[model samples]
Target: MGGALVVYESMFGNTRAVAEAVATGMARVAPGDAVDVIEVGTAPALAAVDADLLVIGAPTHAFGLSRPTTRSDAAARTGTGVLSTTIGVREWLEHAGAPAALPADGATPARRGLPAAVFDTRVLRRNLPGHAADAIARRLRQLGLSLVTEPATFTVDGYTGPLLPGELDRARAWGEYLATLLRALPLLPEDAGATGARGRTETPGTGRSAPRTGRPASGTGPSAPGSPR
Candidate 1:
């Protein structure tokens, strides 16, 4: 059986709930697969992440990925009930190191090219603009990991949210889809750069390197959450 590691950061626990649902969904489709879910603060060291797939999730803050400062703000918010430590996902990624690059000489290497996927929890609003999903995707791509799919966004009612109705189901479905897609991806070390493989045709750590302000695009303004990326 293959293994998956799901690491997530949550302030009001909305994102954490989505992470659990996503893991459950993956388990349903890949019954033989082992899934480990950990909060960012308690996450095992990145060097020890030997899972076949790495799935990450975070809540959108300040129209993009939450910085330490933003996380501090979240913790300070009234009624947040944030019992966990203050670490956020951005800090974790900075220390996670780039995913192993495709091995040279067509030989299998320890920690061969890793495949990753990302998702974000956002407030459900009609016109909310920026998102953490794109930021998260860029970071993974910058790390040289194969992205099985574009980043996925799940919605919440508000910042400290009960997820929107059926959003949990949608997240689960996305996870199952990810499991299926990963199962179909070419896994041989030599196949990393092949056409059918994801993200390898491009240079390492250069997937869709779009210039970003870490803010929403022009004419866009923050509204609610889960803005399309």
Candidate 2:
């Protein structure tokens, strides 16, 4: 069996809602698998991640991933409900050191490069540019993790928003789609080699299997409205 961990950062809870919805969708499809949803502020170090899949989500700020300055600005707003004040996904990925090495006795396997997916929440607007998901996908690749799907976006009414109608349903559907892809791939054995095989997982959104050792999937851009806070 495989498990998934969803880590997210939110300002006014829109992204958190989407993250939970995605987790719910995955649970619905893979009822026997372990699915966890947690705020990025409380997430364990990347080296401590112990799952087959990693899903990350955040709100877009300044047309990209949020920074300490941007997060501060968001908190300064009059009526905002900031959820993460200290750390954001940007800092989390930046601080992810190399995976731990195998023990001298070689009994336990070193951490494998887990398959990953990313999503973001931003405001709905005509021709608005930029996605935190895009930046997130880049960082995941830089960390040597392959993407199981393109970056996803869920729309919000504004910077601080009640999510637009049916966005949660759409998020759930995307999550279900991701779980199906995870089900198609074979899980690594307890004693599998450290250099695990690639191309074992399906391409994002396509049912076809990826080529072995092929380049990680790249995002085409944001597919829907998302958060701007």
> Each model's number of backbone clashes?
1, 6
lDDT of 1 by residue, 1-229 (tens): 3788998988888888888888997899799989888998898755556777888888989888888787778778846457346677887777766555334232432143466777787775644567786677776666556555556667677677888777777677766765765565554232221222222111134222111111122213221112222
Work out the TM-score per prediction.
0.74, 0.76
- Best candidate according to lDDT: 2
Error of 1 at 156 (Å): 0.9
- Which residues of candidate 2, in runs, are more than 4 Å off? 78-80, 98-112, 186-229
Give Cα distance to truth, residue 147, candidate 1, Å: 0.6
Off by over 4 Å in 1: 97-112, 187-229
lDDT of 1: 0.64
TM-score of 1: 0.74
